[model samples]
Target: MEPMGLRERKKLATRRTLQHEALRLAIEHGSENVTVDDIAAAANVSTRTFFNYFSSKEEAIIGDGPPRPTADATAVFVANGPTGDLLDDLKHFILSPMLDLSAEELGYTFTDFLARKQLMLRESHLVTRMMATFAATEREVVAGVAARLGEEPEAIRPQIVAALGMTALRFALRHLHHHGDTAEGAGAEGARAAEIAELRDLLDEAFDALRQTFDTAR
Candidate 1:
């Protein structure tokens, strides 16, 4: 809701820089050949600074990612909420953390994110780290949904909502990957806006499909 302060933006910028360089170096020289020192030097930051943002080069390549909901957003969703509609609210709760922030604001574009994903596919070594990151993200979603429902995290309702939310996100992203708006000039504002719109529409379709499926079952 509130605009990010200069400090937070600066930190995000640094993190983005480190991640971009790490990905770039790994892609070029191969992840096996690249070290923390190489990524840090490429980013023009010291190894110590790199370590502050990421535990290792592999971690940096993954980025501070999957971009979980902020505490503020999660609290609002748990309490007041943007909307009382369960599916709609859960969609917003899961995606607003990303949709609310522009790619430029975060110092990383959607295209950059896709590039990181491609790197993960190329580097088998990063697979384990990526899996752990995804697992942590799922838990966070389950916890947020559970808190809102006043249910334990292991409860079926929270688990189902969390699973639906993640599936919708992945579906939207996969759709985006096939769409061409992001293939070139993704740095342009119009391209970025189109990408956002595409992702939002696909997510809505995915959730709406879920609603339809369940409504028919009922």
Candidate 2:
């Protein structure tokens, strides 16, 4: 992959600083209490600049997620280099991107994401907006996968397959938050890595199930 332009790199750095500051402040004070101005000040950026990156305070705290970490895997699948086994391709695409996150960038505890999820859930308005973004992203990913599989993008089978994949991923993330590196009682990086590994295993199993049900049925 090509290196990021200097300006793009700087922008990413600024965005990360804002996100990190926002998360830290939210963790320290309640999410409700932290204002956009406060986060901007913490990140050394103007409040308007914060708006340029995120739509709202909630988004700043836990929005604009990590870029798809496994694009290479997705590219391989998209190219149909493996005879178009969508399930296998997806498994590789999904898991491989995570490996790209630097250790420090990957340092987030599953527990923290869980806490943020819970907190965001309580904010129904923000939750609603965030869900819209998620849904749109889901469809885009599904369409991309469907295209690679030579399936009609709008076909029920492709949509259903995408839904199943998404559900399994969600379950895996929840499991990580509840029992793995993100267990409520733990806060260490070691625990976090273990949780991530467990989540990956679960995803792999889920993909296996998907393949068995779909590929075998066909």
Q: What is the C-alpha RMSD of each candidate to the true structure, in Å?
A: 2.9, 4.2
**Tens digit of per-residue lDDT, candidate 2, span 6-89:** 999899888878877887788778788999999999999998999999888877777554235245556676787455666766
Over the full model, what C-alpha lDDT does candidate 1 score relative to the true structure? Answer: 0.79
lDDT by residue for model 1 (135-198), tens: 7888898999999999999999999899889889878866674333443666545555666677
**Candidate 2 whole-model C-alpha lDDT, 0 to 1:** 0.68
Model 1, runs deviating above 4 Å: 1-4, 106-109, 177-187
Alpha carbon lDDT at 215, candidate 2: 66
lDDT of each: 0.79, 0.68
